[model samples]
Target: MSQHPLARLKRYDIESITRYYRFRPWLVFARAVLIVWKFAGFLLGLRADRGHTNPIRRRQRAVQLRHILTDLGPTYIKVGQALSTRPDLVHKDFLEELTRLQDQLPPFPNDIAFAIIEQELERSVSEVYQTISADPVAAASLGQVYKATLHTGEEVAVKVQRPNLLPTLTLDLHLMRWAASWLGPHLPLNLGHDLLLIVDEFGTKLFEEIDYLNEGRNAERFAAYFKGDVSVKVPSIYWRHSSRHVLTLEWINGIKLTDVERVQAAGLDISELVRIGVSSGLRQLLEFGFFHADPHPGNLFATLDGKMAYIDFGMMDQLEQHDKEILIDAVVYAVNKDYDHLTQAFVELGFLAAGTDIQPIVPAIESVLGNVMGESVADFNIKTVTDKFSELMFEYPFRVPGRFALIIRSVVTQEGVALSLDPNFRILEVAYPYVARRLLSDESPELRRRLLEVLFKDGRFQWQRLENLIQIAQIDAGFDLMPTAQLGLQYLLSEEGQFLRRKLLLALTEDDRLHTDEVRRIWNLVKGEIKPDRLWGAALGALATVWPSATALVTAFTPSEQL
Candidate 1:
């Protein structure tokens, strides 16, 4: 086997040795290679003595681990956050330690930053920016931000990608997948599935972050969604200068939202700001179905005009319409203490398996909620609930979708940030009213009309199938011999099959072509089972046989202007 490329990059330490032993016991023989140096250090008294194992050393070790993960690159820092959420998957101490993993990477050289800018925008910095600062205002895992001024004299924040970040991230993700695959079968948990999914999600999010065009669109979408709201603000994207790796936006000169004293000094009501923040987050998650996943305090600012400005659109998540409805149902079910409904929602949402026992989980969930739900919104502890959920998930080992996990984390983090501003701030209190309004106000007249049309169409098809079945019965009565009777039964089966095929084809033809897999599968099934000898089946079967190929050909060549 070829040696793992990442193995050469990683340090072989006592901890690595231990992890290897636990995860891959066949590597026990390799322990000799690592132990020799440790023994030599111990004999020389150069390593940690018993007295050195103090709380301060432990703290320093935690700091060192944070630095190591950050140095390992963006993917590792993301993995740190992921592991922090699953206390069951990792040791408690390690989870606590990794939580300190910050995205405070040092900025790449200014020359490289400028090169990235020039390459992405296809112009010199002077052409676009009236004054481009050499120094970065802030630095994070993926990119760094520089304060700049546009040629039009508008102050803007220019986000520049760190040189060679993609290559490093790609390498890390590949290694992670490889390692997960190697250890998956022997591990107690589904490390392979979880790790691959997490890494894939990270890659998708990372790529989106790198694509400044997508970020620009996200910002515009957020702005357009909240256009009438005076209290909320999203930076306007300068499309002329923006590209995949570079983003230019209107910069707000404001205080960090977390700076309560400064915000209060600026004549903003902190309590109202907290309320608005929580409410805006809920709207993003539940209503618009698109949200800023990383709404940490640093990404939010309170402007002098008392408007909440959201910055850094790098990590945005979108919930599908079905997913949004499922989450809402789950939230409502939880509040109502409807365990069965909650479990069913979980299954429907793919959070829990269909066969999983709900009986054991109810008491655990109820105990976790405890008096937290009954308490005033301001008094509720967001961290307590978050921790309880994390712990429960660990014990239960439920497979939550990555998107859902990130959404939950963002909601919990936003709630925590709000609570930090006002101890009396209740997330549920603010969220409840918004959810209630959404439930009551969402009329969806078009959706209701469409649903009725579908039911009516299905009823017509069923009646046609019944009439065909009766006709087949009459034909069967005419043939009294056993072989003829069997053929008649087959004919009836084929007729019924044709009716099913027609129904399916009508349904598929009317629906959007986006569901290609489903359409192809149904079409194939219909084509394979129905035959031409059966008159009722022949026409329907012929359509199914031709539609998939026709659809494929259209999908293939529709993009090209052809003769």
Candidate 2:
């Protein structure tokens, strides 16, 4: 490996780059000048055409942008990867070009990478490993991966970081931050937050990504989230052989989710894998709050037994419990098409700043997202919504929260992977069911409040919405009817149920008329859906404690009042 012809460059480290750092700023600045010139040229051409941007011209300029970023190396490549996920920030054409930066970088020489491994691990590669691959199995922006076996006969994949990254990353981040501060106001960009904030967010995540120790810990934490789950797989970290620059993990033998042919040929159900991906992702965000941020195809795999393996934990993000509840509220509001609450959710989520005059934005949001739920499952996906949302962001004062950048990226990339496997796969088809199940079964006080909000409005029970929720929730294989029934009964009998009970009582005689017909419809819906004799007996027994007259309960549903 050391004799490899590509290993001609001198070994580099933080100390070795001291002299290079002096001229590095100039080199980087010179490249930045070239980039600005190219972009200015593209803008001038668009202006010359009276702002009617030609698609061909846009695509050509996008290609140039991608090439420029790649030429600028790791920092810019990573910046491009972040931008690729931001449909609101970048034009779709430019995003399409920048998406390639997720992978497809030229690999560093194997010999140099091996040298990094030896230095980081404090041992010769041969001493620690029984056998190793001559070249990397995968190359990424920050590191390359090698397949190797330990002396103990354990198979592992070793990831090694690029040399002299700290100095380069530190310098580049400082430069980018300075540039953002200097040029942010003059740029014709629609952003809700300061441009410098975004640079800092990207810089923070990038710094985290290069730390192999952090990535390993993230992998373990992610694995712990899915512990004992059979449908998902996270590779085990080999801590003994790992360091800040090198990571060894149990090798995963699986088919890439994007390899449609291979995945199908492996007899794995692609739709099922997609469902696993969606459901697991939902739990990560809404339940655990920690999520795999970069879910591009290279990071996700389908095992032979139909498990979805998530690799590459270099980029992960978390949500606060408050944010999780707000997100759920937002989803519920969107499902109900209650744009008022949805708009408030945006404000609460930092998409709209405080005192942003949401009154006007509410109608605009309704116009953009109103028809989302009405779309057929086959027609609904995140991409369509985001594309429209990207437009809305331009017209409205909506800003992408820096924290939500990864969340958006994870979801969009997962959906894209699913689409590659099945064109008709809708994220909401699986996502809605999971949300419905959570609302129906979860006993959390926050979710309980949200569920009640979904089920009741204007002091009346929304029976149709309840039925719809039940129907949608039934789609999830993990959604159990008994637990949901029990949860409903428990909540109804609890102290918090007082408000709901009063609403139900008032709904029965709001117009000085009996609503037994509506009540009977609910009874029939429940009876038709839950056929278990034990469930009925239990439900009646529970209801008897509150309503003493079983006969009156039955009599309330006469022919005139019956469903």
Candidate 3:
């Protein structure tokens, strides 16, 4: 028998590589290719530093990677953009290159775009539009946007998916899956399971991006979430021409946030726009828990009327209620330098494994905080903090939750953009106050009432505990307690056996197609027909007797009254 290459590595490495390889063989190859590309890029970056008089070579390297990503098509472009957010994984120069991976691609044939619109709307181009532009106003990885006018003289933007995108994406994902599976057992990196998880998530997101109907719903959802906000604008979905592949939205006339001169020409206050952008993003993450993940300047525009419009909603991330609370707590702890609470919270949130030593993490957390916390919160440098955090993450090898990583990137990017506009602007000052206000609201009357109910229940629980302690003390004083201890242990074992039996039964019932071997094993375990022991078999026998009574008791508690 041969030892697998993955078997030689540590547990995390084996888990990572095996997880991806189990999916498909081609995905494994894709993973290897990406890793090699990253290493090659790193080496090239080193060479550019070796006696190159022209500093422009570094920028050209980035541009080359961006062009390659673009040429690889939509999925790779998306992967490149995602890599742009991972400063911890990529070098600064590479991050710059990946960021340059433009969402803009050349438009598909105009004839195909027109055909898609006609098919989706069930009308001729002449009937729906007084005038339709032959050229696209914007082109993106998956689709292109054209300017058009309705028969009623209303202007709109028509989004059409690139022809045959679905098939291409499907083929690419299939290859990725295959590569993941084949490479699972050999990789030294913990690339197995995590890689597959990322691939699956990517596939799902890619599919959603191609679905215009989903994008339309996302637009409506964003609009509803920010309904009363006068500063924020989300385009209205023109449902009449919208379909799975085609979307028509209200035409937005605005200058890109990146276009400094154009924005100035339009008489928009740049600083105020940047503030609004940052504030709106904080509200989305902390308040709504649903946000537009792609917040690049191209996706953002500033209207002449001083309103900010967010255009793309194809890529969004949501946080669960518990995850949101954990994030809030983590942020608060980070500010206050509460290392213990932060470590505990990380364990509770499964960011750290159970029984992991915390001593190693405390110093790293303190070191990272010490460098930044000494500075005025308003003047703290985001890039420096980010770099320190990234270094700590790699050194500590802590498992960062996927959503948290994305949120960190989103915040850092927004901060960078804001600082570029106004060097004196303090993101922490703007964001922290809003978070503090929300935290304070958590103690309002309604919340207080809920807290009271919980506290009262906890008080009753304490009383019950006190009564149990008194009873146990009395029993210990009155009796020798040896027989009773043995009996109690036996009863506990019996109860555990019954619980496991019931769980197995429920599982078998849900999955009716259980194999013969599985059924035989279940029967053997429950019936004590094989390898019976006093500890386990006697417990099983006791459970068999008590199971009926327990079922009866549960049935008796059901309410007969109807609402």
Candidate 4:
């Protein structure tokens, strides 16, 4: 058998090796060694300054680590933040602590920043901009943002990469690869996916982030996805003045999403913001499969007109279609508290490897969810549930796929922002309706078959699916009527549609007929309107009358506040 080209053995290119040597490989090595050497002293000081057992001391230590990582420049801060998401690599305390590991620094001088822009664009700063801020609006490990006005008079936020950032970060990645190679043998669990795999994935994502052109395309792609959406916003990029080192985008001035008091003071509904945030995030994850991987509060804002504008397109991720299906299944199973099905989803999704003992995994998941979600699944908190579950799953042969790690982190962060404003907000309750709508609209033959198998158990349609559908429809207000009605009409007005509709109605209604409440509601609507000579649309009128669920379904399709 032939091995795959990627899997085949290959020789190292001495030219590339020598190129690294030429580009100050010694400097990278020295910097890495110096950082590691300093780490020993850091550990000693870390212990001497605080007690590990005390919560206050631990928090103080966490803060110390946060500051240390931030000061370590872009690579360390980025690597620390990346590893913080993986439960297998770090503990819950460190994970929570690392969340405070902000990527910020004193802005490098204005001259150097301007110099880089001029060099990249091949034009003087005066030619590129009418006026550029001498001081940066925000500075971070990798880049700084400056408010600039283009010669064409468009207000823009110009992001400038730090001087020599790539060379430094590239060297740090080499050190990381070396460290991962060293750590692989010492790990107790035979993790199918090792540190090398994680580092490689991170390297690809980081490389993408460093390329401003890629960031520009990501912004355009995301904006195109939500082009007409009034609730969501992605700033347009001014690519004429942008490049690998600098990204210029339309300036978005809005209140930070985390500043709840000010947002409320500005007369925007905090709860509505939460709903929009969760819904939009889910659509990216479940529908588009491309998401802004870092949707932390700082990267999000509410415009003066209440639009949720997203910035920072550097760190983005993609969810494959196969993964999306498994995720959808996992969510639905979790919502139903069907741990067995959830385990099945994990196995199919390759989170838990095949042939592994799933018993321990199944009940463990069930216990965690039961404790976190409580008896009422609809009222479950997604952030708490996922956090607790992640902490538990690390014990098993469970791997948080790279795609899901970012998605989970982004969502958990958003949940914190949402909870800060509304204590009663339930993300699952807001998201489940979208799940149902997706299920209903899915045209895939496989999904259709699955739906039939699950809902049409024992030969006829099970009324429970109808009940659940109604329940989900009532909760999701984004229900669109015409297209859904068109699909239903195409199906119902067809031979198969008519057959399935009658069969479902027969299974749901009493003897395939309307009940007293249904009859009364129908009579109340059409008592005086129905005439002896006019019987137009009588079948739909009767269908709506006979089934309360159908009435709710039609109401879902109609234009209304909560439809």
Candidate 5:
């Protein structure tokens, strides 16, 4: 057999591609000309149709754009996938069509796939497995998968890379980078980012996806994060069988999450899976800071045991500890409708430059986010927020950072998956509970400050927000009111809580009289949720810690005013 084209290429990096493709200028130029010709034609057509708001015209343009990307091959298909998630970078109609860019392509011949797989594993195909599928199970831009049974009687999915994928992708990326360098300044795109940076980010992630070992490690780390969670499932990677060009892992048996009929037929509750998806997605973003950036319906499935199984860990992203805290802070600011802080959060998150003028941006943030504050949680939709923010992006210099692009994609794709199952599904209904639980349970100083921001404003305690948080948090099975109350008490008695202490005293006193009604309301909300014994015990423990202020604390809640 001929030596595998990728055998000598152990790794891929955008920075090194220029060195490798320097002699391939003619090939790059030819491909660049082809791409420019296709897009230039599309633009000319778009210019003619700019005369009216015709839905049919818009859709036609969208489909044409999708077809162009599909016809351009794997690298462009990957670029389309990234653009599909970036509403800030693409028109809404085009973005919709791009989402339909299913990375699926015709499978390469099985002989070629098997030959490559055997070469990577360095063994005879017959000796490695008890039984292997004669045909490819699934095919995508980069690789195709086959179902095989290991000699140990374990069922596994074997993924084999397409022949010469690295050369094809690397050449395309190098050409695209050149095209962007030449044409970026002339393009009308106002994404507030360097066009080449976007290309580099995409190139880096694409290279990562082709490396099966990197994907296997991503799977293990993802599994470790949810080790004890029974509601989520991650496939066990078989490293001994996996290689740079091939991956083998325990096969997951389940219906795709979007297959509502099949899932219901399997006796699994679709609503429960949606809840699991929301909560799990939250933990990936807000807690672990690592998330599956590509969570399309095909990558998510519902198992027989009612757990959500995550597959294809090839495209995952991580957030720094500080980024996670900033995200949580942004959520708190949005809930409080503190546009100033929200604007600041945007700056910290790289959405805006540090020294950029925030005056114009603050109201824009409010206009998009503030509108949702009035809607009931059950009525709130993430799609609505993203759609409006898409508009906000054009009106200002706001840019979706390269990292944030994946974060937005993961969230929006998760929400899109949920909506496919239930039209009445409101992501906020499930998401707010997770946020509330995180606020109540996490003792991190960042979250503590955020929680305080949510429960206090203008030197007055916001009793209603606290009560609402408790009510919403109880919806999550993982939330325990006793421990939450203990944490709250602990924070209140600590040095940091001194500010809250002063605010609590002021809120309680009106004309030198205690205002007990708000406290009563909170008690009523918690009474049914917490066991009386645990609640009282926690209360006693807190009181013991602050014995000196015990009498005053009790008196503040005593009925001394009209109520």
Candidate 6:
């Protein structure tokens, strides 16, 4: 067999072993640092830190934790915050504090920053920029932003990746994974798999973040997704002057979504902004399937003119068609409070493997949905719904798909920002009509058939579609509920149903012989789930009308005990 690319090159001494060996010393240092943090964490978890029977110390512990994360710098902030998200591993209070590491440390020296920019873009500073800022406007763990004007006089933001970041990130991850390997055997949880999965996720995001070219493409794709919407603006990229380490794009000037007071001062309608944010999020999730994965307050801006502009496209995710359809069906099931179908959707959507029996999980799924959808539409809280499910997540054989993780993260983050804008805001409330309309309009045969189930009970019409009618009244160009009814009618009149009625009649009248077992099999379902006077139900009754004579003839043809 041919060797892999890395090995093939290594065979010719094309890659040096020396640079690989550099991991050893950094690994040792990172390990010691991690050990200290773990010790501190262990102490924090003790009853004394929580102040057994002492509310005062318990409150104080949260404060101490906030300070510890602020002092631990980039690596800990990233890994710690990631770990905090796992309820299986970290305490809820610690998770809250770990997420606070949003602002970055001081900027690196200007000359090194400028040199890296030049190296990546392959141009002199004068060629691309009319004037660049002397200091970075903002900094983050992976990179920092500088306000600059392009040569064409278009104001732009230049994002420069941190100096020597890749190697350092590599070293930090090696140490982290190495520690996970050492600690995995001792933990009750699947620490190795979970830790490595998170680390791999973080590393992927880090690499994507550093590739300014990829970030530039992401911006273009996002722009394309919302190109026609006046309220949605994606910063234009100047590709001729951009590269893997340096990204240049049109700059946005707006009040941050989190700055509630300033936004109110500006006389902007905060509630309207929340609607736009929620609509945009649903479009990404249910419609386009490709989404800007990070919609945190800092990355979203409400322009003075009221457009909801998105920034930071480096962390983007794409949902495949199958997952999208399954998710849409799941949402429909939830809206209708159909837990059985919802559990089936959950199973088909890789929440469980294909063909997995859903009977064991149906009640558990119902319990989770009950707490979320139990409230009236106006009072629904998407965040609370997610939190309720998280409590029950551990009881199942569930694996969080990467796209799903990003979707949940993006949704929760944007909702947080939206809530910051308006305390009364509710995404589920805003999203209901949009999702309902989409569900009503779905033209797929399978989905249309599901709609039949939604619109009718057994053999009778369920006028509750009028309730869906009211739910969707807010959607522009309100949905045609008539189509759903038409579909239900079409299914009953379909060839398959007609065939069943004819097949049974012929077996009874022509041959004076009916398959007794087949007749019972068909009627069982008809009696159980099909309404007797309903379309399929009445047709089934027609077949049963001949069953008495058919049964007598069958008995006459048979002997003894059968009679």
Best by TM-score: 5
Regions more than 4 Å wrong, model 4: 1-19, 22-25, 41-61, 189-191, 444-447, 457-460, 481-486, 492-563
Task: Give a tens-digit lDDT track for model 1, residues 49-136.
Answer: 3467566665655565566566556777887776665544654445567755678788889988888788778788888799977699
Which candidate tops lDDT?
5
Cα-based lDDT at residue 513, candidate 4: 61
Backbone clash count for every predicted candidate, in the order shown: 3, 0, 26, 1, 0, 3
- Per-residue alpha-carbon lDDT of candidate 5 for residues 1-563, written as tens digits (9 for 90 to 100): 67634346656565567876686688677887888898998999999997789998999989999889888889989989899778778988787788789889999999998888788899988888789998988999999999999999999999998898877888888887887899899998866688888788788888889889999999999999999899999999999898988999999998998778898899888888999999999999989999999999999999999999999999999999999988877776766567998999999998887899999888888887778666566767777888888788777877888888888889988999999988888887887788889998887888887788787777677878888888888888888888788778977887778987888888788457787988898888888767756766677666666674784576467565411
Number of the candidate with higher lDDT, 2 or 6: 2
All candidates' lDDT scores? 0.64, 0.80, 0.66, 0.74, 0.85, 0.67
Q: Give candidate 6 misplaced runs (Cα > 4 Å).
A: 1-19, 34-70, 190-198, 350-368, 394-399, 444-450, 457-460, 476-563
Candidate order by TM-score, decreasing, is: 5, 2, 4, 6, 3, 1
Candidate 3 lowest-lDDT run of ten:
461-470
Candidates ranked by lDDT? 5, 2, 4, 6, 3, 1
Model 1, total clashes: 3
For candidate 1, list the clashing residue pairs, or say none: 212-244, 377-426, 378-424
TM-score of each: 0.67, 0.87, 0.68, 0.83, 0.92, 0.75
Error of 4 at 5 (Å): 29
Candidate 1: what lDDT?
0.64
* Cα-based RMSD of candidate 5: 5.0
Candidate 6 residue-wise lDDT, 313-372, digit = tens: 877888987787777667667877788988888667655667777788888878876876
Q: Model 1: how large is the Cα RMSD against the reference? A: 17.9
In model 2, the worst 10-residue window by lDDT is 4-13
